[model samples]
Target chain A: MKMTHKRRDMLVGLSFIAIWIVGFAALTLYPLIKTFIFSFQDVDITVEGIVTTNIKFENYRALFKFDLNFMDLIRMFVEEIFIYVPIIIVFAMMIAVILNQKIRFKGVFRSIFFLPVIIVSGPVVAELFSQGATTLPLIEQYGILDIVTNTFPESISEPLEKMFSEIIFILWMSGVQILIFLAGLQKIDSSIYEAAAIDGASPWEMFWKITLPSLGNLISINILYSVVTLSSFATNDVLRKIRIDMFSPDEGYGYASAEAVIYLIVILLILGLFGVIYLILRKRSVRMS
Target chain B: MITTWHKIKHKLIGRTITEGILYKVFIYLLLTSIGYIFLFPLLFMLSNSLKDIDDLLSPMVIWIPSKIYLTNFQLAFQTLDYFRTFFVGLSVTLLPAVLQTFIASLIGYGFAKFKFPFKNVLLGLVLLTYIIPPQITMISKYVLFTDLGLTNSAWSIIIPASFGQGLNSALFIFIFYQFFRMLPKTLDDAARIDGANRYYIFFKIAIPLSVPAYVTSLLFAFVWYFNETYIAAIFLGGQVPTLQLNLVSFAQSYTALAAANQHFFSINEGVKNASTILAILPMLIMYFVLQKSFVEGIDKTGFAGGE
Candidate 1:
């Protein structure tokens, strides 16, 4: 009877996880496997379904083959990382730090900070763009995407528009990060700060030595979450192009697949690089510990 | 002479008077300023949503409208089919949230009460889900649903969650687990000695004692799902009418992003805000109604304690 009951308990847990397995497999696992398979196999997704008899590693090859357009895609991704990431981090950090301070009306400020978490996936992206289009046309008549996007083609007239869409990407996603930071800040023993002050540590020094050092774990999570979240934005040059490709009338979906695979590879590499940096930082932390 | 006198005053009374006064003034000015900064865009959107087409196109309303054009809300409602969307969204959100919370509590109870093998492994797996970005599996999950022929069905949204989302459930499980574990093992021991089975003890003693946690998980689910549309967008593909779908469809109609203006999205954004306010009002209302419980829940849950 005990054995039977043990088996029953095991089955329940197995069944519980199995449900997640199917969801994860269907939503993520299979799509991930299919992306690579479809990338190599010249197949039209909209018409001809997944047939993968033919395969070549050419998609990966062409990604780094180094044409001007290819290089431009690479450059655009980097420029975005440089321009957008810092602005988001700095502004979000500043806002979070300020909000973390002991201020009156804390609850209202907390609500205001968390507002963006609720604003995901709506007409907001488009409205933000159209609003930008008005100003971007004026900016393009001068040239700002040239500075930001790096390759300011005279062909692309709506500089302000592109920047506007990009700004929406940059500005909108800080609520969770602020919360994470606030959580991290709150975790620090108040006595540590009290003692530090009693020992003559300045705010800047304390932030670097005590506060930031302690928040290493959260900072890594914040960075990872922020980066992953940016993947959904329509403004991600690669993702944007791939989406356009998927929706295009005359679908050279093979090429589009190639672009998408290449984009995924690049994203994976970026994530990998971040992971390495985090690992190194974590090791150094361990040594310090 | 004035500067020197000021410096001396700053030195003597500054620590108390200056810091206190400065903190008060700064808190008021700085916090409120930041509050306005955070609030302006939303307020801008709310105001813009109400403007007449003529006003919408004008250089700016920049301030309160001459007349409150309630027509936008009417158009938004009609266009987005807000009534239908609201109810469906409520059910979808409520089911997962409740189920997740309950399961978390049960699982938490198990972890806390019984000495189960691989409990640590199970807990670790639970924590791992919190880190894995949901996007990684989104497309694959959609494909899975497509294969299961559950596409565009509520099951696609509901069933996976019957298992659990790592959101409140996992965290709640830990919270519940911790609280249950912290309870003197004597309670369960005494109940067992009285011939109570695990289920009876769970339902009778363990559960009744976990009201704060129940409320925490309840509110967590309510708030999280109230505005949640990420999976809804992918799973339902926005062809169906959930609240978010209503908003998206509304936004799409009005949007010029699509080659032609659909007018659908424009209509939607207007009513969507009204719905947005409505959708969230319950959460804020819940907070007000259970302000004490909400604060206590946060304390017990340790949700805000650390990263």
Candidate 2:
């Protein structure tokens, strides 16, 4: 009876997950394997079906050697992640902290901040940017872009200018991050802060000691979320290029597949790098406290 | 006088528990300014969309339009074929979202409740799927869909979703996983002891208890699907016209319409902005109506801490 009951549990659990297992195998794993294979071959759809010719590393070679803008786009993607992720995480944290306070009309503030997540699609964002709605009029009127360009080297200044121009868009992307942080903030027991206050610890001290430490995991989560959203956003130049190249007769499926594979690898490496850096910092902070 | 000044300052900047009047003022000011940055784009969109050509061109006419101009909206509505595309968009987004949310809940429940072989590894793979951009598998999926005669149809989008491979399906599943995990195992145990089967317990107990999770997941999945232009454009670009896909081709369509009607008015920023607004208007309305669930759902789901 015990053995049959245990067997029943296993069967029931597997049955529940049956759809997902099929989806994983058919949609995700199969396509992933096909893409990997297609990356190595010259693939064409000739109505008879997909025809493949083994091209060795030619697609990858062409990407690195002949594709001038691909490398640049990849660099810009990494740079944007570095610059934008921190800004987003910090801005979100600040807002979450503010919203968690005993303030008036918290709902209204949250609604406004989170509106972007609802309406923000690639086309909508592109339209907004094209119409110059993304940047503040003050930015241009004050010649902040000119000042930044003159102040820093071109490599550093270019991203800074891009950042300043799309500052609001960056803030808009933080809607989900803010919610994540706010949730984390709400979970922190008020009693801890009250106890610290009784011990004569200042708000500033409490923020660093209690608040920041408590939110460390959430910060990493936000980092991951920010990087993924920014990279995969419909308006992202790299993704746009990948989509366009898929149909280009010269590049076709193989080259596009190679590019897609490289992009996946780059994103994974970025996440792994962030994970390591976070682990190291967390360890040091733990030791110090 | 010095004592009085100190007392005033102390009152304005209280220590510890009570935030002083000065601090309260500072907090409000900070919040309002940050809130303005968030609203700036929408405000810009609203203001610009309502402007006539003269208002758009005038340097002085920044925020206020000279008058409420309806021409841009008229042209935009005609170009978008607003109602037809909206329903099409809704069908694709709404159906997929409902299916994805339901399937995600089932998968999430399975992960949360029963001990299965390689469950931990499978869960990790689900997270891995979220990280892998859709671009990687998109081409092959497109080919597969094309082969199955699913391209240029709602099924192209709906089929993947029904199978739990929809837009950000993994995230929805994770949310469900977190929510279901938070439910006490004792509930399931008691149900079983009362001769309730596993399926019965899931439907009767687990599903009923996870309303907040279901709401949060469904709302987000719907929004994400609605705004998903990348896959939608690739899959349903031919026959199925979503509002977003319409907006993507707005300029070209406007040009075509203008040439056909011989209406010599060139497409202006106002027309473009108006169309963009139309594309996002449904989502904006939905957000406003369900503002409470949209905001507080995150808190109730215990989304951040369940790891």
Candidate 3:
């Protein structure tokens, strides 16, 4: 009877995962492989079906050499991720700490920060960016942009100006990360802080020793989430360029697939770097404790 | 000496006899600036939407309009086909989100509770789905759907989700797995000892205990589906217009209609802004009404990933 019960448990578990496995295989894995195959072949749609001709590395070669702006866009994508991810993570951590503080109308503050997540997909955000609404009339009136630009070298100033202009956009994207951090903050036991306070630890020491170490997992999660969201965001020129290239009548299916494969590799490499950092932090924290 | 200065500083700005007043002031300062930053877009949109062509053209009339103009709201409503498209949006969003949440929970429960063959491999694949961008697979999926004659049909979006493969369904699965794993195994053991069947235990015990997870997964899944533009545009085409798509195309459509009517009542930025505002009104109302669950749901949804 026990043997049969064990067998039945296995059966139930297998049945539960079966649907996901099937769907994953059919919808995700199969499509991914098909895209990979099409990356090497010239594909044409006819009345009956798709026709394919093997084109070897022509698509990849064209991707690097023929596409004039592709390399520049790739560099911009990498640079933006490096700059934006840290700003977002730090900004989010600060906001989360503020929101998590004992204060009046905490819900109102949270709602304000989170509102962008809901309405950002609407035309208002895109319109605001395009029309210079995000530049703030006061800043522009004060010639802050001009002053800041003159402070830096021209090459550095251009990206700085762009970043300054999109300050609101950056804040808006930090909503999810802030919420994640706030949740992480809530999970830390208050008793630990109480004990530390009794031992005469200052707030600064408490933050580094207890708070930051406890939040390592959440930090990594936020890092991964922010990285993915920033890369695939509607405004990410890399994604837009990829989509345009995909349907571009000049490059067609094969070339776009190769570009996509390259995009995927870049994303993976970034994530891998974060993963390594997370591992190192975990080991160091364990040692320190 | 620094410790003496620190004591003085603490007396002045840190803590007082009032207790937490300093903290309150700091929090309020932070909140106000960030709050203003977040609210600026909506405020800008409202200001723009209410301005007439004359006010819009005048650079001095940036914030306040000389006179309020309300016709843009009416024009946007009519052009957007608000009632029809609203229902279409609701059905497409709710159906998949609801189905996907339940399916994801079941998969997550399985992964959390029982050991099976290739379980690690299966879990790895689930994570792969999370990290992999949807854009990479979009083209082949589109082609497949087109061949299957599912293009321009809501079924194209709905069917895959029913099997737990919707937009970021992997994340939902992961969330549920974390929630379920946190549950003590003693509950399962207790149920088994009581002669409760596996299905009975899951239906009775696991489902009831996972209310927060259900709420989080369903709410996020709904929002993602509602705001999805790329896949919706590709799949639904011109047959069904989602709120996001309609907001985007409102300008072009308005211009086309105006041209047909000999350019009577020329379209302006106000109309476009008005349409964008009106398009988000339903979501705004829904969010405000259910703001507590929405906020708490996000808190309950994600688990820290070290384990």
Candidate 4:
């Protein structure tokens, strides 16, 4: 019996995606559900097998009521997303714009900028951080840290201090973002810039009116990428804590799962917040144009 | 004289269409400075790795060493168990990366070309996987893998990856989808008219055209897997020693080795720096070797045109 063309296509499509479907169910979906369940239960490992008790919201309650450190970690994570995302996006955009120009040794510059992405593992970065290689010594030598601390209030100064201390490492995180921005920058038609120029737009004016708006979608993409990379980094204190708590006799799997759930929710919230902001800005840009 | 000076200023700072000398200099200066910032840590690592005990301690010596230091490298080489761990690292990272890349290509081809029910939803699900942190599922995956006796072995990584759930697999699928979608449908249609089956058309037409996607995805997968320690540490159970895992325990390993040999030299910054350098050396070499494709492949990945 011959199948209809539409049916044939559908079957073929399903066949192609069959492995992914199975994988998603087993590896992603099942585990996701299991994690959710595990978060509410008191999970224990026994000699015979695994065991769980339904202790709904107890793990979460304990986390909020007792875990002060978890709260601090969450605050730091949110602060990092707020501080690092814009800095990375802006730095990446700046470097990408420069690299996109008609310049000599562009390849050399590009390779140098992208070097960090290749070698930035958890251990390598941890070693660098331990050895004080991640920071620029000049910042200390030049007393920029002192000035910033003195100038700003504690709330502002704290993040500023972090920014100064890990300045190079922060810049290192921009390697992939730079490449992403560069790709976006390259795709912009030069004719638009030319037309704007003909209409008496200065370079600065062209950047704001044409380049920035054209890169609106890319800005959001970069923001998402930066947030994910920063959050999921191996050496993240919160992740490290979760991993530690997983094996602790007092906490076990349930508490750790609860922490993971909270972390996931926070990440989703950040992404949602960014998505809303991006949509609002995009709408404004469209209306303005 | 005033008119001449004004003319010179205009020439030095060209209009929007053309970059003038001042602008060109400014661009180069900015690029060079930022480039320095990017290379600072690497330079610091290299310089410190070469420093001896005296040079490391001495205030006079900053960027350069007083004398060349081979002892640190020797010590680091021993501490890392360099050769054995390197291949072990390859077994987990490279093998899984290859499997992940191939599977991602097939899945991407599916999403790109085929018009099927819930296609958009499925594709959205693929991206949703990327957004979901691996930690959320890791606990359950750990339990599952432990049950299957896949823990502490490469199978734990390889199995998930082969099924298209590896590290950053969704991004690769998206990349291939972008690449395959960009290919003209006429080629596939022509092949079909000649009585080629769907699989035949895909294998012949689609795979051949998407070399850039494959290369880009493979490189990224390899690098990501190679660098991944959190998941590796959890799943591998520290029985399988990758370079990254080894590096994490470098100090302990060094102490243990020193005790075994009964040679008591305190672990110094130079030795630690050397180990760090050694850990990243392979990836750094790979990046330089594939420098062009590494940079240019970003363009081919169609990252600029997001869904």
Q: What is the C-alpha lDDT of each candidate?
A: 0.59, 0.89, 0.81, 0.89
Native-referenced DockQ of model 1 = 0.21
Q: Compute the lDDT of residue B190 as modeled in candidate 1.
A: 98
In candidate 3, the residue pairs with backbone N, CA or C atoms under 3 Å apart (3 or more residues apart, or in different chains) clash, namely none
Chain B TM-score of candidate number 1: 0.81
lDDT of 3 by residue, B1-307 (tens): 9999888778657653223456566667868977987788788889989998999999899889999999888888878888888888776788899999999999999999998888998898888888888878877888888888988988888977887778888888988888889889999999999999877888899999999889878877887787777667767776777777787787788877777764337887788888888988877987898787778876765554323
Predicted complexes: DockQ each: 0.21, 0.77, 0.59, 0.76
Residue B178 alpha-carbon offset, candidate 2, angstroms: 1.1
- For residue A78, give model 2's deviation from the true position in Å: 0.4
Better of 3 and 4 by DockQ: 4
Predicted candidate 2 versus true structure: per-residue lDDT over A235-274, tens digit per residue = 9988899999999988998888999999999999999999
Model 2 pairs in collision: none
TM-score (C-alpha, index-matched) for candidate 4: 0.97
DockQ of 4: 0.76
For B71-190, candidate 1 gives per-residue lDDT tens digits of 666555555555676676766677777877777677666666665457677667655454443443444455456768777877776665665553334556666776777667889789
Runs in model 1 with CA error above 4 Å? A1-52, A58-97, A132-172, A232-268, A279-289, B1-4, B7-13, B16-28, B57-60, B100-140, B165-234, B237-239, B251-300, B304-307
| Model 3 TM-score, 2 decimals | 0.93
Clashes of each: 22, 0, 0, 0
